[model samples]
Target: MGKKSATVVLAHGAWADTSSWGKVVVLLQSDGINAVTFRLPLTSLADDVTALDKVLALVDGPVVLVGHAYAGAVIAATHSAKVRALVYIAGLAPDQGETVADVFNRYEHDEKAPKLAPGDDGLMWLAPEAFGIAFAQHASPEEQKALAAKQLPISPAAITVPVERPLWKDVPAWYLLAQHDHMIPEKTQRFMAERMNAHISAYPVDHLPSVTAPELVATVIVDAVRFVDG
Candidate 1:
């Protein structure tokens, strides 16, 4: 195999830590792709983007930034020239002047999806059952329990604030639409992908496919890396 010089930076979504990308990271490394997972503070869109920028600066080569669910907005909120391509896994993409809430709420939420509201801490959290019920229903009982235990809470500021001009407009983009995602409707994902002209790869997976269907997640990211490496 040819030497793969590009790096894949994985960003986890709301209510998740970097551990969510555990499976995908192992698979990318096995294929000789340098991969790293960036943890979002779930504070605000600006904070997450700033944190990602710091991680991008440390990498030595071009990058194929990959985001899952809500992290999709974090990955696109950067101005890093090193980021050559973007891969969105059941991600949310908002256009310029639009807020993440705008795009995420464009389509009606599934009845099974949880009603998210911030606790007294001013941070919104996902209920433990939501992991098994909607987030990653495909995941095993043990895995779902573990996923719920280490969850993070996202700030309303992160979703309510408007996104800047998206990097997908200029960078090559690949979208993995999760057909079974109850959180973000499949039709909503399609609308965003088509709006950005991203290459679409739909799969019968839930919102957290990076956790339940790592192979497919890795493949889409690898494809984006190859496109940039070429």
Candidate 2:
């Protein structure tokens, strides 16, 4: 298989939708790599994994699974055989018996990180004002506003649920660490990436590097595609 023959499935993190991967998808498509993104309901970890599994089933041949933020854990929980590689974009990779919250709270959060709280509906959202600075500081004012407007709230239960055997332990993996991320500390991202034995690509971007630095993000994903296809 070649890079163009492999499908790249992208999973967005919490407080984001498929649009989060818009730029990367465009780049991948332009390169003749089949790229697609799925919408995780942000309801629970299991549900998100199942949703990804469904997307995987729809894709033909080999796939490189790319995840961001919470979707990192969601992609790891998948047992799909079609997934040839796993790519983490400042994603959380929890080991078996560990919940996303466990890994998330392991490190001291950045002081500027937004204080997240679940509404009565049990969905957690980032503060609208914090979206620009904390999430995507590198993005333009118009892009930041669009991101805030289309943001999706994740359920609290999603973070608390323990993960199964992480796919990273079985499949080759790559991690793109956002150095300026306030939501998940850079130290934490390094820790998780090292534990997964992932190929690391560190950049001076914020949490939403897929939006802020899509070219860099696409380059990393394309590397993974080549690696897996070879």
Return model 1's CA RMSD, one decimal.
1.6
The top-ranked prediction according to lDDT is 1
Clashes of 2: 0
List candidate 2 stretches off by more than 4 Å: 1-4
- Candidate 1 Cα outliers beyond 4 Å, as residue runs: 1-4
Candidate 1, residue 153: the lDDT equals 91
* Tens digits of per-residue lDDT for model 2, 1-230: 44446899999999889999998999999998999888999898888988999999999899999999999999898888899899999999999999999998889997889888888877898777788879998889998888899999998989998888899999999999999999999999999999999999999999999999999999999999998878
Task: Estimate the Cα RMSD of every predicted model relative to the unseen true structure.
Answer: 1.6, 1.4
lDDT of 1: 0.93
TM per prediction:
0.97, 0.97
| Residue pairs that clash (backbone atoms under 3 angstroms), model 2 | none
State how far residue 193 of model 1 sits from its true place (Å). Answer: 0.7
Provide the lowest-lDDT 10-residue window in model 1: 1-10
RMSD over all Cα atoms, model 2:
1.4
